[model samples]
Structures are given as C-alpha cells and as structure tokens.
Target: MLIDEAYKSRILRGEKTTTIRFGEYEAKPGSEVYLVITPSDTAVAKVRITNVERKKVKELTNQDAKKDGFKDVKELVKALNKIYGELHGEDEVTVIEFEVVEKFESGIPLKWLKGLNYRNPEEIAKLYIENNLKDSPDVDLIIRKVYSEGLKEAVRRYGPKRVRDALLKAYHKLYADGKI
Candidate 1:
C-alpha cells in the first residue's frame, strides 16, 4: 500500500515527478499526469499512474498552502486533522454500535431476545438469516445487507477487542444452535 521512495525525483529543481503503479496497472500520460482507476469493484482494485517525468506535477500556490502555516505535505496533513484531544471530536468518526432488539419472522418481531439487545449485529443478523432461510427466503433478505465487507468495516472502526467479543457471542449462539 506504500509507494514510498520508489517513485520520486526532482526533474527540474523545486519541481518533482513521481511515477506510481501496482500490479496489472494501465499506463497513461497527458499534459499533466493521468490517473487510471480500476474497473473491478469487489477486488479492492488498484490503479497506476505512469510516465510522470515527461510531465510536471501540479503544485499549490504558496498563498493557498500557507494560509494556515502549512509549508509542506506534513504540515498540510497535520492541519487537515482537526483533532486536538478527546476519543473523537466533531470532525472525528466513531464506530456506531448496532444491536438486535428482537428477531423477526414473516415481518413479525419475536421475543427470542427476551427484550435484550445483542451487542453484535452480525451474530444476531446471521442467526436470523440462518433460521429464516429455512422457512422463507424473504425473511433472509436482510442477510445480504450485512455483508462481510460491512462487518469488516465495523471491525476496523471498532477495535479488535469489541469485534472479537461480538464475534465470540455470535459463535456461542451458533454453537447453541448446533450450526457451528
């Protein structure tokens, strides 16, 4: 994921050109530089920018870059971060915890949860799907909404500890149902 020093050069003093690419990437050139976006969606596709030396990479004006004392990339990046302190701030993002309040079959909520919410949405959703997929595929419709990618995103947003705890609870439920 890091292109690093593998693609950098000062073509003409004070200006630099950096060529970047990954495996199976297309090559392109332009008045400036061409950025190629991959076509596939499910593969976490990669893109490549080739032949940058023949072109000059664009630079921001001093007035634009230094408005907040941002002299370079590091300063600009630091300034972009609005966080000072606190677990999360106004501009910061937090993982929202989702719970299953109850189960449903044929659009009717069940008392299976005993009025308690499950900490893990995936576990609850998985169980609901597994149970419903037997009688009616309609009840399992929400399963697709809870994708592996979505659950992984939740794992990334929340720490591994929380994700693992939820996963364990889900596993326990699966075990109880003899579906593990």
Candidate 2:
C-alpha cells in the first residue's frame, strides 16, 4: 500500500518527531512570566499568546541569549532595561503595556510604591484554591530570593514601615487571624 510505504519511508528517514509548544505556565499573583526568545523570533512567539486578559511581559533575550536564571528585580530590571534600550532603536515595537497584572498573597514582598494595577485578593484566592501554580519548590525558592533582593531597594525607597504594612496588608487580606 502507498500509505504503508510512506509510513515506512518516513520511519526510515528518521522523521519521527513530537510537537512541543510551550506548555501551560502558571504565574503567581506577585509574579509574572516573560517570554525571552530571539529578537528575530519574537513575533512568531508572540503569535502563541493565548491568554489575552492575563498580561504578559515581553523580555527580549540578549544578543547572546543564555539560560542564566535572573536573581531579582534589581538584576532583572537592569538587564531587561538594557535589552529594551538596545531594541528601541533597532526594532519597531508597536505595543508594550509593562503592567503588573497580579501579585500572590504569599509572594515576594514589596512596598508597591508605584502602585501599578495588580490582581486583587479575590482573584489570587481563587488561584490558590485552584492550585494553578506548578507546586514546585523552586517556585517558592525563586520568589523568596527575588523578594529579599528586590524588597531591599523598595524599603530604601518607601521606608520600612510602608513595606511592613504592605506585606502585613497582604497577609491580613489573605489570612485574617495571622494563622499562616
């Protein structure tokens, strides 16, 4: 049969392959996901944007894009802003909202000085009950590391009281009796 011959030929030609679109990613309330792909390939990657209501941040990888883990806002902001600077002149980016859409209750602590629009308590509580996050230990570890490093600058900016209150507010909003 022609179909059998075609299948045999495909097998013999090493054409067996698996499709791998990026899997579903869960971004915690006090977190976000940045798609870092080749600048040349960003438009293609952007097409795969499935969640329109959920804000997505675009972080163009460096010309020499490596798989290094970003540590904190200080480091990520410094590096990512540099990427923005480089692309500002070279590429014509049409849209960039640069918004904080969500923040987890038990996420990286910050004063939220600028008070960018963020996902509120109810949405986050829903996400928590649903257990949408991957439930990976690395997620908490990364959040803690990023929070400690980022909160230092925020405290210096907004003072310790505001930072403490903001963190306490988040806690109280989630757990009224401080039983976390």
Candidate 3:
C-alpha cells in the first residue's frame, strides 16, 4: 500500500485508519500489507486490512473523510482530485480500512536487497556474509552448510549463541551503514 508522505504521521499516530482510493484496490479484509511511503517506496509499517467497501463518490460523508484524515468530504474530494484528476460524484471508489500492526523506527528501503523480505535477521546475516565476508576463512563451508542443512541446523552445528551473535552483528552493521 503506497501512501503519501504527508500522511505518514497520521498513519503512525493512528489518526488515519481508512484510505479512499480512486478505483478498485486489491487489499482484502484480514490481509497483512506493508505501508510503503510513495516516491521513496520506503516500507514504514505493516498493517492488517479490517474492511473494504465500494461506494460512489457522492456517498462519501464527513465520517468517511474523518477516518481518512481529512477535515470534511469537500477536503477529501479536493485531495482526491489532485491525486486522480477530475472525479465525478458518480465515480466509484474503494474504501480500505486498516489497523497498524508494526511500525519501524527506521523505514526499510524497498530497493535495498529487495526489501530484504521484511528483514529477517538470519537472512540478513546470511546475505551480509555472502556479500561482505565472502573472503573470510570458512565462509564457503558455512554457506554450504546453511544451504544444505538450513538455518536451524546450521545454528545447531555452529552453536546457537555464535549464530545469534553473528546475526545481531550483521543486522546492526547493515542498519548502522544504512544498508538496511
């Protein structure tokens, strides 16, 4: 779900719970989706869709506008017009209601390692090793073991504490270096 940067604060503060899209939107009820800020495409939070309703523009009310973080229907319409060009009252729109599940302190860059699939710590460690520590001794052997035995098995073989420490180190390094 792409949202304007202007609404980032509202979303994070729980002021905005519903979004009125110009046309049919794919978000389904009870589905979890990432809230990505537009233009930057930074993943800021995860949300669960609570409801979805389709309605004509003319049916939009002050309540709808309020849920969308607008002062009134007129304000909402104007903003919608600015985003989707001219819209008639007869035009259909989709209303998506959602609740924030998790918000990130530092948003994940969608382009970074393909968003690192929402940044699993172990996965980050594996990729970090592959990309930054490939020349280190035992790198190849560890990589092979991880691929063949999976992360849990690798953790057992290498000691859980060591694997956890490596994962934490990799995560912090990536975060500190702005690679996450």
Report the number of the highest-TM-score candidate: 3
- How would you encode candidate 2's per-residue C-alpha lDDT over 63-133 as one tens digit per residue? 11221123333443354355444322233222211222232223322123213123332333343334423
Model 1, residue 176: C-alpha shift (Å): 0.8
TM-score (all chains, Cα) for each model: 0.22, 0.18, 0.67
Residue 46 displacement (Å), model 1? 22
Q: How much is 65 displaced in model 3, in angstroms?
A: 0.2
Better of 2 and 3 by lDDT: 3
**Please, what are the lDDT tens digits per residue for candidate 3 over residues 58-153?**
999999999999999999999999999999999999999999998865565555425344564345756665566442344444544554555556
- Runs in model 3 deviating more than 4 A are 113-115, 118-180
Selected candidate, larger TM-score, 1 vs 2 = 1
RMSD of each: 18.5, 21.0, 10.5
TM-score of 2: 0.18
Off by over 4 Å in 1: 1-128, 132-151
Cα lDDT tens digits for candidate 1, 45-98: 122332322211123234333432346644433433433332212232211111
Off by over 4 Å in 2: 1-149, 177-180
Clashing pairs in 1: none
RMSD of 2: 21.0
